[model samples]
Target: MTAITVSRAAQIRFSPGQWLTAGLIVAFLGLFLIVPTGTVIYTAFVERGTGTLTLVNFADFFRSELFVRSFWNSVYVSAMSVVWGTVFALPLAVLTTRFDFRGAMVVQTLGFIPLIMPPFVGAVAMQLLFGRNGTVNLLLNDMFGFRIPFMDGLNGVIFVQSLHYFPFILINLSASLRNIDQSMEEAAQNLGSSGFRLMRRIVLPLAMPGYLAGASLVFVKVFDDLATPLLLNVKDMLAPQAYLRITSIGIADPMGYVISVILIVVSITAMWLSAVAMRNKDYSTVQRGGGGMARRKLTTGQSIVAYGIVGLILLLVLSPHIGLFLLSIATVWSFSPLPDGFTFAHYGRVLEDSSVYIKNTLIYASLAGLIDVIIGSAIAYLVLRTKLVGRQWLDWAATAALAVPGVVLGIGYLRTFYGVTLPDGTPLATLWFMVVLALAIRRLPYALRSCYAALQQISPSLEEAAENLGATKVRTVRRIVLPLMIGGILAGFVTSFATAAVELSATLMLIQSNADAPIAYGLYVFMQSAAGRGPGAALGIIAVILVALCTFASHYVLERSRRLVEQSHGTRH
Candidate 1:
């Protein structure tokens, strides 16, 4: 029997339906992702029009002073954002995870609020509150006879990005802290280490994996960001330069392609370094009974200090949201600590004239979310439950989208698909459906991860039992596997939908008409003018509400599903 099993495993077998599903997935990814990205890379390396391979494009990139400066500027801004992010996140993560704090849950909950709004949307509000001649600076000058350059040049970019991206670190590090076995810390205390010294020597080292993961993510996201820097009018960064070059100089220019190649390299390198840093390091020491590291109780004086620290941080964290709300209602709000006047006219204006943006967002995000869950489910099943050859390659290909910047993907789509016209002779790249595809591709990795996690929690024996009872694979997946995985699939869809709704980088490159624009694009357009700031802020708030509702709905669905499953088990037992 063992010999027969081994021989059977060595051979490939699939039903017609399985073969069809696999073929369709491969074709979709190859046509939309691989071919377009390859075109961009190829354009960077080959001679224009002649198609002859050459190194001149890259040589020119390194030799140009502007491009070199832009490269270094991006590096500098990304590094500084990570540093500031650590300062903002480290204390919150430690206090909430390792100490007995009353408001820990609140801190954790509010910390994620920044992520709901895009950093660029917050960038304008940050300027109103933090910029020179803005609210804070005006107050400081009046009281202290001096002003600080919080939103001056690159400093502005770093400040806005750090505040927005720091939650990534906080969330990852908190989870890591909770997973640390208490035995290690107790062992360190046995050796007379009980304070900050113990944390530095033992706890932090164990949590290094989470720290690096979050920090590297922050770095990549900031580096790939296009709208924030452009909104701040800091155009010397790589992403903005790529957008400007491609849009202003047309697709024929090699500079944009070269910069895109460099962006891909940096993104890959950051993720690689994070992985290499954790290589061969076994920090997983959670024993069966080890819930987590024991928490320390704060003394009375310590409580006051901790609360004070949290209060100050919370104020900074909520500044953007507050400023945005005030700006939305204010008739005039320049150089004032508060809005000159408040009104609901902006919201009314948005509802009356900008309903198209909201409608389009609902349609596009829903379609993109639908596409993600389907592909994510298929890929997850193929990799986990099948013996198909090269099955793992599908997972890798889907995940590799994480390293491809949105702008790079947008550029790739433009170059690869612009020539293919519709029946009306319209360029395929200019169509609105291309926007949905770009969003789906950009967000696929996230959904795939969710599906992979969902499938991992199921026991293989259940599927084997169904098959032994003569159930077909299709029927089993539909009736058994998918129903069980619905919670994760819904979670993935919400994540993809929320993020895709606010995504502006790729859509900025692809949107060819106002009628096809989503909320993010409309927000960007409104934000560019002083007269439109109120309406733009109103739109931003609406986007936030939409995402918040979706998040709540997902949680409600998951809870309801859990109760239903428990009731079914009770009846069966």
Candidate 2:
């Protein structure tokens, strides 16, 4: 019997418990993500009222001059954002990883600061700082007698988005650079390859996979982004058009559904392009005696230049945080370099009246995070541990959510579930739980990756040992697998919570009232009005604080746990 059990486990045969877990996950994903998205796609290709299959909706989309222009504009903005993001990221990544730059850790840490604040929240603050009559231009006008159009029209959207998202590139590129075997660089150096020529030829191509990964992410993110372009008032973009069509025109409008289809297609196409670029190219270099690339010391001039560049990027990244803080307290900050006076009235008002946003965000994000980890863990376990038929399909399904835009998902939910009335006669889509579901589906891929990492680190032998001792599979998982994954589960939960707290695109559509709004939705509503900017800035600050605290706390706890484990091992030795 023991031999049979071990053999079955080795063969990856599905047990009753595994089957049950997978069934639950499949039902959840089908009910929430697949169904809604499918509804949007089906509606896009079908004739309205009659539900007859037709291509007229897509043809209408192509015929619309506004939509055609919006499509191109979205493409241009997304591509340019990737280009600018690469520019901001490349130097920092190279300087830290290639050379022994001082404060490399600090540079990397600070590089990630912009990610905590949603790009849309920074749009208003950026306008204040980089607008025509704003501080930077004003200073430039005074000093150089010329003002650069840093925040004009589409330029403003690209600038803020690039500054906010470049960290994605920085992180991936730096890791890639670090992983390049030192021997490869040494061999190139022996052939008299040095300096920029060597780096361009040898180093970059090796790290292209990582670069493409990050660039693809930046492209898709910028492409699907609704709030940033909306906050910037650049509505001649696909995402904003989709959003406006649904909310302004109505959810039944095929234009909105058509636009959502285009968004998903574009996202998939970009990812496919990235994959195609890296396909058939072997980048593996690490071998025996080859750990990572060797770091070289920078010269005095090089150090100064590197530091200056890093400092400038850091300042630009931190500008939103600084400007948000200033805007929140400023009595009146208009047509000037500084505020007329300072007051905490904005914060007070937010805390007093708009505290519901914060409360809702906490509830929604917490619930979303909970859902993600539970589902993510199950998928990860099924994929890694079981050789059950189609186990990998579950992972692929969950990860597919990454390509679906938030606005598209929102439209999907409205179209698919709004007609499904509850026992209370309320539209199913209007319920706050639907908002949580949208958030979870949107962030599920990230949480799934985290769970995969956690589960991968655990040994199958541990479970096998438990099972050999007559413990049931469920009991072993409950006693050993879950406890071991606590750290990763917590980490995944915090990540989902932090990101979901500021996710507005879907929430914006789902929010039936201000009472059900999350921080991101409330921030958007607040940023829309001139009078509401101050309160919006205050709310933005609170969101930044909330995400920062959660991220920092998770990092601190994980690090502390690692230290404790190391200490225990050291004492044992």
Candidate 3:
């Protein structure tokens, strides 16, 4: 009878549970992500009026000097940003990881703080500090008798992007350095390699994979960014041009679709090349156990120089935050080293009039974050636990969202869902629910990564043990797996929520009214008016605080979970 049951089960293509889970994932990704992205690509190749395939869009893009320049401008900015960002990052990573310093943890923690704020949120404040008539230039004028255009046009785009994204390089390089087997370093040293020679010969090439990963990310991000260029008033770049062509010329414009396709292609290509370049290159080492690259304690002079360099970089990186905080309360802050006066009326007005933004952001970002972790948890389970065919493809498809620019996705969503309405008679695009959906789709990759990493850490025996105790798979997952994964799920939620709260491009396209705008849109609106700069700065501060609080909460949950895990292990042992 049992053999007959097994034979019948073998005949079935999938169990009921597997079918349900896979079906849900396919539907969710299909309805929100795959369909929209497909619509954009399809529209790009066809004529708007005739709906016939044509090469005119590609031809026109290359023929027009304006479009061609914008394309190259994106490439130039992304390339330069990666160069400058690596220059900032490599030394910082080396300093913190290769030497024992008292402030290493602080420096490491503070380095990543720049990523927590959206780029355009700091644009106005950066203009106040780095623009021709701004604070640094005024000081430079007083000292050197000349002003430099640090924040001028394309130059400013590279500067801001490099400063913000260098942390990616730093974090990746630091991890790669720590993970390196120490035997290679000692072998190189025994061969008369020392100082720069050691790093040049042994370390750099081995860490090349990490560097490539970070550099490709920097290029993709800067290439697709629309807000920084718009805030800096550099509209000749591809992303800004895409925005202008769509918003100004309307969504029917073929040039806009052409720009979107190009952006998506370039982004995916950069990431793919990075992955391919490192494949089969084997950087493994024979070092045993916990041995990593050796750390050397810095001499007093070296320590001082390291700290000084760190201090200088931190000052430059934090300028936007300090300037924004001051500007939020300043009555007037123009053409001077600092503000002339300050007040709290901006905050008061924000709380009084624009508070809906804060509330909606809380609702929209929270729901998006919750939805992302649920999806992430399911995907991670299917990929890691099951023998299901094409399960890893679920992970690949979700992570592919990283290569998709938010602006392109925004255009995709608009084109795909323009006329769709809910049962309540409200257009789907106009609902706050759409904002939540869009934010989830954009940030799904982040949450999925976190959940996948967490799931990988758990032993499959835990589930087997649960099953041995007469527990069903659903019961075991609900009672055992979810609890073990709470820390990572919490982390995924915070990252998704914090980043979504600051999403500009998708939010700008889908948001139906002022009543529905989030804090990011509020900041954008206030920054546009000269008189509204104070309120804008105030809104920017709130955003920074929101992100900081989310970060803190994530850390707290993770720490507590770690302690609990350690306790359980101790009890078991």
Candidate with the greatest lDDT versus the true structure: 1
Pick the winner on lDDT between candidates 1 and 2.
1
In terms of TM-score, which candidate is strongest?
1
Q: Write model 3 residue lDDT over 388-452, tens digit each, in one string.
A: 77888889888888877888888888888877877887766677787888899999999999999
Model 2, 1-573: lDDT tens digits are: 999999887786567888899899999999998999999999999898998999999999889999999999999999999999999999999989888998999999999989999999998999999989888888889899999888888999999999888888999999888889899999999999998899999999999988999999999999999999988889999999999999998988999999999999999999999999998989988685347788899889988898999899889888988999999999999988988999999999999989999999999999999999999999999999888789899999999999999999999999988999989899999999999999999999989998889899899999999999999988999998987787788788998999999998899889898888889989999999999999999999999999999999989887877687678769999
TM-score of each: 0.98, 0.97, 0.96
Model 1 alpha-carbon miss at residue 16, Å = 2.5
- Total clashing pairs for each candidate: 0, 0, 0
What lDDT is reached at residue 344 by model 1? Answer: 90
lDDT score, candidate 3, position 223: 95
lDDT of each: 0.93, 0.92, 0.88
| Candidate 2 Cα lDDT to native | 0.92
Better of 1 and 3 by lDDT: 1
